[model samples]
Target chain A: MAADRVDPIHQFHINTIVPIHVGGYDLSFTNFSLFMVIAVVLSGGLLYWATAGRRVVPSRSQSVAEMTYEFSASMLKDSAGNEGMRFFPFIFTLFVFVLMANLIGMFPYFPTVTSQLIVTVALALVVFFMVMIAGFVRHGFGFFKLFVPSGIPVALLPLVVAIEIISFFTRPVSHSVRLFANMLAGHITVKVFAGFIFSLGSLGALGVAGAILPLIMVVGLTALEILIAFLQAYVFAMLACIYINDAIHPGH
Target chain B: MFVTSAYAQTAAPSAIEAHEGVAAGGGHEAFPPFNPEYFPSQLLWLAITFIAFYYFVKKVLLPRIGDTIENRRRTIAGNLEEAARMKEDADAAVAAYEQELADARARAHEIATKARDEARAKAENDRKKVEASLDGKLAESEKRIASVKASAMKDVGSIAEDTASMIVERLLGSVASKSDIAAAVKAARE
Candidate 1:
């Protein structure tokens, strides 16, 4: 029973050497390190190769690369307005990195960094920090006023501010958890159903018939995972846009 | 939001173990608290992604959108100019057609008027010719009548003279009766 029961979440653990005692902190790199490096190389190579010898009329590869660029540009413009153009580089990079990480994880024997809560949360925190900094930089002391609605009565100010602060703090948690949870759940489901098919196949005719159900489920779940991968990347980019919006227009 | 609840349900662990077991039993592994700082790969990626996207948007995407819009504007403007030119051409063609129609109408009127005048002149010439022929015929008839009148007068005179001669011969047989012949001549003259 112990061998038969597989822990889905255990597959996502990142094994590494604890950081060498440089000072007091462990700064050693891990499997997550290797995967991230691979992701960067893949993204860079693809983008560079696609755009290197661009003609007036684009080739298929160049058009795809350009489409990626345009898609993010339009998203930023719509969500964050013209000022969002300044953050275009950040948003585009985020989208590509997340996309690459998600796609790479779909391959056999590839680790999904986004499936880790720590990685996702850290990324979300950066966005959260940038949003706060941008708001403060633009509005100065008035940045704090974002928590309090303008038309609210003085008595209701405390209640609104508390709610706003709690919501604001939850942003990073929710953002990170969304990506991590989705990736983790999707991968686990795929692995478990795959295990079910193999485990059931060892039995006779009835087991063989039962194998078909898990096989079908595996195929269906795999297709769903691919969709979720794309969706997660899009959601990550979209949330970045929304956070940037707060910086550009704070009152709302 | 719907995804959040679903994730929460799936992620919930079965039970939470108390920490006091670690000090009392000393056999269980220490449970680590949730940490947000475990991953450095994410930071490196964040840097890479930020840099790459920054360059792409700056150099490629925005420019393409701008170009598309500019191209559309130019196309629209060109269409408008072409339409205006076509309208002018149509107006010119319509005006020329109207001018030609008017000229044809005037030409037709002129032709009808000239034909009517020519017909009137021909009729007048014909009436004059008929009147001259009638006058010539009347003059010829008058001449014939005059000659005939003269001849008839001559015949009548001759007949009378003959009759007188016969009467005289009968009355004055041989050379006697000169007074009788003279009286008969007087009677014939009276």
Candidate 2:
């Protein structure tokens, strides 16, 4: 007797609120937009509060905030070098936004913005474009040389080049899909298992007893979802830095 | 069945035109995630929010944090340098103290050795002076004994001559001449 409200797909649904259409597009402030604003405000507020004192000896929250900054900064530098520090703000924002979205989605009935294919695609495309424009601008035609690996057999060069080109073009798809799919699948699987609890409990005594199994499964899955949330954000930000590194120094 | 039924709405001119039907609770038969109707709004909002977030991070958050971190590092480094300088000064003071101690000990040893040598030399000089005065007194006593012995021998000789003269006079029943007695005694002594 699991109702339609438990529909795993229903959580991803967008219902328009405060409908605003300009130039024939539904740009209405939906739940997604509301959450996005919430995420921004929350993250910004956290940073502000963490940095309020800036003492010689940092407070606990101040140290945490500093660690996060250093983590993002080092990730970029390790992958992309010192020049990569220039993109630290954007990378940090991307990292914080995705992390917040994923974490907030852990709450029941909250929509994960990152779960949307369009949102992830937009983020990936931004990185992709930054890479492309910066690559071409910095290296010109030499950017294409990235596809050409050094020390390749003449006969196999074409095959390797083709594979490299395809992989390069598909970077955004893979990058965006990795995060989107992790969020979508994690959320959906948890919902599906949650629905099982109701479905099983409705079967009477034995069924109610069996519901504990799914309940445990939901707990474990939620914990895992939290891990995936942090992991996916890290992966996204790390790959973005690596891609930018490729633009800066494209080679074998 | 839901997916196939919703595909029928795709024939509606454009994505924007079709969203109205979908948004109006038009019995969603299509896969919700794959629905293209939501892309524009999501993209637009993402642009607006992401740009705003980036500016907040770049302008406000980053600089504030960076400065705090930098200031903290500088403060620590300055403290470390100061500690090192203080340690160096302490080490120098200790070394100087040890050097001064060593010099004082050596000087004390030298002064003690000189005082002992001067005392020994004074004692030796006093002993030599006493020994030399005692030697002079012993030599004078020996010379006086030799002269006294010679006088006693001369007295013994004169007494013997007197006794001889008395015996000669007794034998002759008259006093023999002193010259004759003396001549006889001298001849007998030779």
Candidate 3:
């Protein structure tokens, strides 16, 4: 019982809720999918309900809604300039979805959606392809100038181009890995520390006192995870804005 | 390797298949996140939710929020403009009041100056008229006194002449010439 309780891996397990098989694919709607839908409804409904008043002066809830909109808008504009507002919808959606998922996962027994490699990978790929397509469409063949910095020694030009190409291609991998690893590792650490509380509390008074240390650590880590949830969402959207900016202006 | 196996074992697909799937790859299946079987479903759902979210934001959610914010901004701007216009009106009123005050002061000063000049002129005119009448009365009184003194001197001269003729007649005890006496008196008067 203690071993399974300490196993943080079980929390990430996918359970088939409503199994739907189409063609040869097993496109089953699992717990992860349920959480995604929840994220959608929560964010959408909150935004819709919060802004219904449309008060000129703004109430407390209205301020929250406006703050969310301004936060994403300013971040995108800051990173990619005013022209970057073109991709505001896509970038804002990603931010809200990821942020909602991270916050929801903070609850006991809630599966973290961003912890999945597939989900982050898919998000990153979308940004990557969007940047590439925008770059090609805007600058045409001149988009290759991104890899070739203007002030470079002729002899080192080939090496520089190779490094730039590799880094550019690996953007999606590092981007996805950063968020996935953070969520997975943070959840595991929290769970592992929480398991100590259960095990030590069963050992009587002295063990209860000892369990206090891990309990404090769990509390601190949970707070840190909350901060990181906002941070990761901001970072992801900001990075997307930067990539889209690169596509909009394909120079160094 | 066991995508079909998991499908077939759907009746009891919870723990046994998961462990079996892990065991089948000789521990190569490793972490649950890296498993390929769940990738399709997670990706598919992610695509659905994200796309739906994107559309909702683009169509419904964003417009509402944007309109609220825009409306607030416009209201604030309009309020500020009205306040500025009111301030301008107040300043103009104050200026007009001050200007009227200054004009009234200037008019009062002009009236006072005119009244003071008229009063001084009237006083001066009355004083000059009194002085001219006094001068005329003094001149007439002096002329009357000189005429009375001249008449008294003529009477004294006539009496003196008569007295001189009577003394001569008494001393000589003889009748003298009347014409001579008259001539003597006339010469004495001269």
Candidate 4:
């Protein structure tokens, strides 16, 4: 018999064109680049279309668009307060792009960029840099004072600062890992269940009966994954808002 | 040797052995490393998204919310003003009704008082007429009584003179003097 198909991990490899030399480094766009572009265009177009008419009494599309805007706005306000308004556009855009990329992947033959660590990490890095810059700009030299809480004894300051810095550095890692792990685990589970359905189907009547169970599981998991995709986007955006709050008013 | 080699090639590798072999041989890079400088397109799109959302919130959504709130406030104010005006109108109507009620009561009282006074005056006039008629009747009855008494006294005097004449005739049995009889008759007649 022909060799059984390779495990799904092998399929995750990014294929690219000739690597471009840039500043003594190889930089090449891959399938992730294509998906990111697609996500951007689709998100932009959907929002534009949804809000194009600007009706006083909102149309269905406009209502949906407004709901999305209000949802993110309220979330930011809840997490970061009025100071969060300044970061609304960035947070909203990030949320929409991530949500679109995740949903698009559910379609046949579409790639999920969120499954890639690089994309998730890059997005997390942007959030990280923005928080850093905002803290520096707002608090100036006092930004470093964030690592030390007020009322702490001098003897405990060193230990407290070390812990605070470690926690701070782990923010991006956890942020990117949350998205990446969710997408990877959901997709792998789906693939494994699909494989079960095919592999069990060939055995006999009992095997066919057994295959039905996995098929049901696959369908259920698919639906659940779709919900997770939306939740992940929301979580990502809300956390970014929270981080921004810490930057705006550190040490509290 | 060829048959043995073909058989060996046809046998499948164990899962762990296959995984180890793939790990050892799959050294070829699948893709080049990502560089931030090459992702200008992504950065540009990010900028575009940022600007679009910024404009949407600032120019569109925020203004709409403000306008809706302002309109609601204006509507409430207008309704309150209208209600206040209606209340004033109702109060004026009540006041007018009360004033008209007082006027009607006063007019009715005035008319009743006049009717009562007129009835009293008419009663007084009727009483005076009855009293005058009664006094006149009393006067007439007294006059009639006096006239009747005079007539009765004359009749009695005539009778008395006749009786006295008869008595004198009886006492004188023979033919009395004609002159004496004549005198007696004349006295009776007088």
Residues A1-252, candidate 1, lDDT per residue (tens digit)? 434244343446444533322343334455666687677678767877776654545688877877887888889999999988888778887888888899999885677878877678877988899999999899997787777778999998899999999998899999999998899879889978977877788787789899999999989998999899989999998999999988878887
Using DockQ as the measure, the top candidate is 3
For all predicted structures, in order, the TM-scores are: 0.66, 0.86, 0.87, 0.65
Per-residue alpha-carbon lDDT of candidate 3 for residues B68-150, written as tens digits (9 for 90 to 100) = 88888899899999999999999999999999999999999999999999999999999999988988898888888788878
The predicted structure with the larger TM-score, 1 or 2, is 2
- Chain B TM, every candidate: 0.54, 0.66, 0.65, 0.55
Per-residue CA lDDT of model 2 for A166-237, tens digit only, reads: 999999999999999999999989998998998888899999999999999999999999999999999999
Ranking by DockQ: 3, 2, 1, 4
lDDT per residue (tens digit) for residues A8-111 in model 3: 67677777787777776768898899999999999999888888888887888889988989999998898888888989898889889999999998989889
Instruction: In model 3, state the lDDT of residue B125.
Output: 94
**Residue-by-residue lDDT tens digits, candidate 4, A113-156:** 77766677778988999999999999997888778889999999
- Could you give me the TM-score of model 4 versus the true structure? 0.65
Error of 3 at B176 (Å): 11
Please list all clashing residue pairs in model 3, or write none if there are none: none
Tens-digit lDDT track of model 4 for B1-190 = 1222212322333454454435533223221112232344334334454456546555655555445445556777999999999999999999999999999999999999999999999999889898889878877887777777777766655555455556666776545555666566668667
Q: What is each predicted model's overall lDDT from 0 to 1?
A: 0.72, 0.86, 0.85, 0.70
Per-residue CA lDDT of model 2 for B80-146, tens digit only, reads 9999999999999999999999999999999999999999999999999999998888888888887
Docking class of 4: incorrect
**Cα distance off (Å), candidate 1, residue B132:** 7.5
